[model samples]
Target: MAFEQPLDRTAPSISEAIDHERGRQESTLGMIASENHVSESVLEAQGSVLTNKYAEGYPGGRYYGGCQHVDTVEELAIEHAKDLFGMDHANVQPHSGTQANMGVYFSVLEPGDRILSLSLSHGGHLSHGHDVNFSGQLYDVEQYEVDPETGYIDYDAVASHALEVDPDIVVSGSSAYPREFDYERINEIADDVDAYHLADIAHVTGLIAAGVHASPAEHADFVTGSTHKTIRAGRGGFIMCDTEHADDIDSAIFPGAQGGPLMHNVAGKAVGFAEAQTSEFESYAEQVVANATRLAERFTERGLALVSGGTDKHLLLVDLRDSHPGLTGKQAEAALNDVGIIVNKNTVPGETRSPMVTSGIRVGTPALTTRSFEEAEMGIVADLIVDVLDTPDDDAVHDRVTSTVDDLCEEFPIYE
Candidate 1:
């Protein structure tokens, strides 16, 4: 069947915007730590006819009719997730990582339950416990910070804080942190305090699945992650837990949080998850970390101060305060954006700048590694970023870097 629609006529503006966005992606670098490009097959699956289906419940036991095919898709996604992450059960219905977190919270905690998580300025996420987010508003929250000198999460400090707060749940994992969480230690702390450990591995879902990073499935009571970020799967969320909590987690997503599942995205997840299980994917994951390490080395040689001094994963957080004094993260982001080298301004440990204008920038290698960039290319890219940061106001520098960025984008085309 010819499934193409007359999008040009029906929605010209939207179509044009999409075209421009595609052009933007094809031309610019996507260095945002949380973002990665999906495969063409995943794209096709996400745009399939399954989008029209409701599929309000889990596989087979749906509330709507005509769900047999979607049932198969969801089951494949769940099975693939379980196999990849080594979890007893997987729930793929949550619309986003945050929604997945909501399902977990709804499943176990009541209103005003205490949540102990890392501080946002110290590399945590809003969903973990920021005042503006629902989790913070709904729960009594206490936050721990990375050690100022070492720029790493101090597990001992976390233990002390957990003991003092007596949290109902202890959240591990981070969004912009360069180092890894000691999942075992955090889990032990939670166990000692009789608190549930929720490890939100949204950013490192791919790395964990590839076995390049540690998996929290064996340590945490609940594991939540986005299917896209490093995993390069569908643009949705998932939850993994023991068989004991599977039913509650599933029900929480169905009736407690979101209404209907996005079955097309589920199809995307199935395809991407299948893609992730390959030896090629394992190589890709390894390259991601290698490229990041190269970036860290290059950035350091160029005099950029990394948050943790280095990364054990695919991202690095550059603190502009020491390296480029008086230059705000917003300024650095604008400088890089002007030259087509994409990155995000972030809050570092000991951050004093407002959230709108942070003190640091986060750079990641997943998208570039997906483009088949190795250490050499990554080193070059790192130099380009540092050059922009070094001379934000120099037009000659901007023009030169822009040419190199265009060349890199052309050489490493995303879809082509």
Candidate 2:
């Protein structure tokens, strides 16, 4: 395949842009739960000649000409994804998780159909049913929330709500809650309500593939996930389902939702899927959990209040109510960013503050774990975080934390 090379003097150099991005990653500690650094092979595939193709449709059925190579790439991506998740069929074309959800909704629901899902404030994605999203605007969205006291999903409550709502679909999975989901139980609830079960494993796809987390493919009727999060691929989305819904799902993603697929990203997804099939990827997934646990423990020991008391996956939600009294999540996020620790402010369950100024921060170990940081290093990171939070005004402490973070990051360099 002949790829178009950028004219050297036509624009800001692509090499310069790449170098700047690499510098940003090298200098900062990325602690966002929904982010990760993809492998070089994935990057190469994402930057390949496949990007120039205009394959408006699926393999062997393009709406445009010259799609032979892209067809091969997309087919590899779909097959590998199906094998990885043990799904009967796969759709590797959604532009994002939101789009993936939108396609699913289009496939199985009408404009005014009642859809039940987890509450956004209680760890659900925006596409699941946030009032501002298309899902909420088009459908009658009823939300199910976690128990405030236990910080876990109340299945009994969820069942009752499903029964009352009589939804057309019941969506499981979360963006923040730290625990394993009982997919079987949730599926049973959906079955009793005569609703389809859709599991969004966007945050835990890597763990699920590594055998560290439960696979929802066998239990849920449909599953959607992002390739960039735990999967460590380029930014994109995928959908999987049983054979019965395969044709409908594929049609929904194509003609029903998006037009031409980004063949470059599809190629990257194929590379990522191949990488995940290896033993090393399994080890990486296990370390992601271990690093998160270590970080959580360190924060607890330092008197920081962690949501749900701790984490069972690669992420932690720290409630700053008690430790940093009067400090908002926005302030904390800014302060931490100043010290080279990148995390996002997030809402806690029943938060008093708005989404922009949350009362909590979400942190994750995936990127650090990708850099090969272990338990001991996580303890150091915990101490640095505590120091910064305790003395946000101290420039010296911030500088020290920055320097220490730089050094630690150097010890476990990425993309070298």
Best by lDDT: 1
lDDT of 2 by residue, 1-416 (tens): 12345543444587678778889889899999999999999989998888888899889888898888888888999888988899999999998888988888999999999889988888888999888999999999999988988788889999999999899999998899888889999999999989999999999999998999999988999999988999897688999998899889989999999898988998899999999999999999999999999999999999999878998898988889889878899999999999989999999887899999999999999999889898999999999999999998898998899999989878888877
**Residue-by-residue lDDT tens digits, candidate 1, 269-350:** 9999999999999999999999999999999999999987999999999999988988999999999999998899999888
RMSD of each: 1.4, 2.0
List clashing residue pairs in candidate 2: none
RMSD of 1: 1.4
Local lDDT at 329 for model 2 = 94
TM-score between candidate 2 and the true structure: 0.97
